[model samples]
Target: MTTPTAKRWEIVDLIANRTVTAGEYKPSIKDYLSELTVKPLTGIPVALAVLYAFWSIFSSFAGALVTDGFMVKLFDNYWLPWIQNVWPNPDSVLYFLFVGDPLADNCFEAFGMLTSGLFVSIGVVLPAIFIFYLMMTILEDSGYLPRLAVLMDGLFHKIGLHGYAIVPAILGLGCNVPAVTATRNLETKKQRFIMMVLLAVFIPCGAQLGIMLDVIPETVGWVMLYLIIGFCLFGFILGKLIPGGNPEILIDIPPYRRPALQNICKKLWVKTKGFFINAIPFVLLGILFVNVLYLLGVIQALADLFAPLFVTWFGVPKETVGPLIAAFLRKDLAVAQLSTIAMTPYQMITAVVLISIYFPCVATFVVMLKEGVKELAAAVGVLAVIVFLYGGLIHLIGILLGVA
Candidate 1:
């Protein structure tokens, strides 16, 4: 072990590193500094969060106007028709294989404006992500996010978490990656693991919420409310069931103040850009995968298998199976797929609930790997079982209550 003097020196070096990189961050670990809260301001942070959510809703509306009015008109009507004219029967087999021609009765459809993942992302996901990042960065910087551990202590206790467990669940809404990173704030390995598991299973992000609205329009709010309740109730139940060390409530409450505009802008730009860079590729690939699977008649096979389940139990169409499967790859795309099928309000509510509780998502799955292979497997198995069980339970209750 290093001598006390050396540890002090090492910590000083670390603080210097943080101050330089984070600009506003001060990560001193000295006894006096350790006692001080890192968060220096607050009210603005919470206001910013509220603003960000609504702002995203507004911006997405504006984006929809632009994409629908200009892009859709230009690409779908003008460009696609010109392409079809030039191709004139586009009857070639290989062409039909890759790009389905409805005219030729080929199953696959070509990558067109209608199926352009990029267009959809621009119209829907980008605005929501940007707003989400802006809100989250403020919460994180102001230190209220840390204080949330304190605020939610009582609530979490009702859920099964020692106060420390609340941190990951809240952060999970911003992004599961950082939420997993924030799990380090938990006091012990067990607390972090359980919290991580819960977050991956129940917490719904704003982006997910946005897509859910578009996919199943009739009962989005009710679905969201139910999902939140499910998250809280199940989390409480699991926390109590698990035999682990009691979680203590210890957080640094930073003073409240107005958020810095410059800081918010800078962080928002970086985060939104980073999100687009990472997610755009995955979305395009998902689109391509769906197209190929549909081309090969694979989607139909699975749809047939699940038609009864979707129509009878969940109250959605068999066609919803593809989107539900896409959810295992990306929740946004899965939700987007829901838009094409018809369903009642009850089905819409159940669909969103099932989607919210269904999977940890691909990104979440990767984060679970950090817990080690065996631990990740156990975590996934438990999550998978719980999601379906809870979904089925909700459906049964709905039926009994005449929810449909």
Candidate 2:
């Protein structure tokens, strides 16, 4: 037995019938990797590099290649044409529902279930979702997420959130529904609400980001930059307004291990299936809503009603009213619809930014309500103010930069 001592070391006497000698243990490769990847100063740059690589691969390579080169072209050249051919009558209600106008160059302009819905849901967004989740799952399993969170703890504390809040924020990039639910891990309602607000206002879900990549590839980085700046700025401001003390982060940093391929695939499948099941139905419903509203001529009416706010203030076209209405159902679908309009990259960016901040999808809204009605109401008020002010602010920025 060793006795307590004031010094760092205490020696214990060992008694055994037979003497035994053991070889010394040597450090493994993971031990060396951690020194660079998880240490304080080096960890930050390495994390940024990993993130940059992730964005480049997911957005520029896989998303562009699989979505634009293969899926969109497949739908435009074969699937959409076949549907249009089968239902040649443009005036038929069935044709309107499934095919929209047969004369449109591609499914994007067609705005129907078989056309726009299929293209946006399966063709444009699905591939990106697949790739994004694949990478996310890999990171999650490899145990690097906590180290990255630690690197971000100082910055997060400045905004009244501890490092652990990064989990929900990262999850928000995949989908806000789960992200909102993940907030339960937070200690206080104020922290949860603040996190929820920041997610709803700034983080672009994978599907929405996919459409943005397809439509505004050249400036997607700039769009993300603007959103991140807004996220940090608003988070700090909201922290000051909301009453909450940020608790210090206490987290376990797991040892890094090689991620198994089977596990990654299974996790990807579960997440992708959830997204497909929830999001695809809403996309089809969005197409139906658009067709019915356009048929009733109510779309134009609503466009007129909101013309001053959307058209004049936001500097986007009146035609965006349909997409804005559709945003409540599925934001990615709304972003897809915006791509069909003949707007400059700046106008498109303005609409994208507004939709990002305006409100969560209907499912997320219900979750917020369940969390607390009063809190939800206050969140709504904050959303509205930010949407209008930021919407106008981005437009002014566009003009100054001459992109609008």
Candidate 3:
């Protein structure tokens, strides 16, 4: 009969079967995995709840700072001077009205969205996302994210999706491009498609939502709430419609701990850098594109091309054409430009919602191409068309219901 010590040695030897480690420090896979379980899970949803509250408060303060202070000055002092340097007629109403239009100003300062709206829009939005990501990363590293997946599984399963889709939902709050790109983590094609299209359609990014609240007032809050409800309902319906295999989840959950400061900064740098590098150029280029389009009268061409739909079908002003085109580049910027226009609360609500899911930003677009599902590209086009159509529909429906 083997002694107790011999039994321990045998277990060690069995664990070390794959290695040649003198059979001393080896252990079974069960033992190794058990080491991970020793740390108690204070749970995931609680951490997420904490994080949501943090972002909401901080983001509003940042948006207010930029809108009232930095934004006001950048336009008044710097942008005005730069425009004057080019047009020599900086004080003109047209110059003030369409701050980025190149007519009475050099194209440099005429980029209204990048200059005027950037601070309040991006400065506020990015920080909020950063705080959110920071909390998410801590939760993730601490093993809360996996447990979160488990906790959410029952509800998510009813929607025909695995709970892992929560990762993209978090990302979608930051931006859809990264969220779509993240679908790579999902095992099946169907999970990826449902997550991608649903995320693209329903989720409003941190920046757009922040600015919408800042610019539109209390009623926009109602629109925002309605849109969120719309997202959940549609997301559930799409998940049911999409067919997919659910892979069994097996994740290593680490004990919760302080995320290293270096890691948070690195994450912040990578994400924010990626965001701006994609954003700034597109914003400038969109303004440039508009400048050229206006120069060549292509905008007029498109407006004339679709005049009936612009005036009759959508119930928005014809001038909204420029902002709509600009949205393909950056939705927040396009929405900012829309603030300069005179429209009713209903029109504003409809326009904002339309642009909310209008399309992924340029950075996100590249991610879509890279993720490379044949259906997703088509989904992008479909979502864009739906954004406008749905926006109009929502407005019409709300009016009929007396909510509008």
Per-model CA lDDT versus the true structure? 0.64, 0.83, 0.65
Better of 2 and 3 by TM-score: 2
- Candidates ranked by TM-score: 2, 3, 1
Candidate 2 achieves a global lDDT of 0.83
Better of 1 and 3 by TM-score: 3
- Clashing residue pairs in candidate 3, if any? 100-110
Error of 3 at 165 (Å): 1.0
Query: Which residue pairs clash within candidate 2?
Result: none
lDDT (10s digit) by residue, model 3, range 1-404: 98999999999988788576453777766455334333334434454565566566545554555544565556556765564566546555445434554442322234554445455435445555555566666666655566566556665666566767777877777777778877778778877777777777777776676667666765566666657776666667666666666665555555545568788778878877876776656655666566567767887888777677756666666777777787777776677667877887777777777667667666666777776757756777668666666766776775787745
Measured with C-alpha atoms, the lDDT of residue 222 in candidate 2 is 74
TM-scores of the models, in the given order? 0.75, 0.90, 0.76
The segments of candidate 3 whose C-alpha lies over 4 angstroms from its true place after superposition are 1-9, 13-48, 66-71, 74-114, 117-143, 217-220, 247-249, 310-314
Off by over 4 Å in 2: 1-28
Candidate closest to the true structure, highest TM-score: 2
Q: Give one digit per residue, the lDDT tens place, for model 1 in 240-347.
A: 776677556776566545679899899888777767776666666776677677778899999998788767766666887787777766677777666556776776
- 354-399 per-residue lDDT for model 2 (tens digits): 7788779886888788888998899899989888888888888888
TM-score of model 2 vs. true structure: 0.90
Clashes of 1: 5
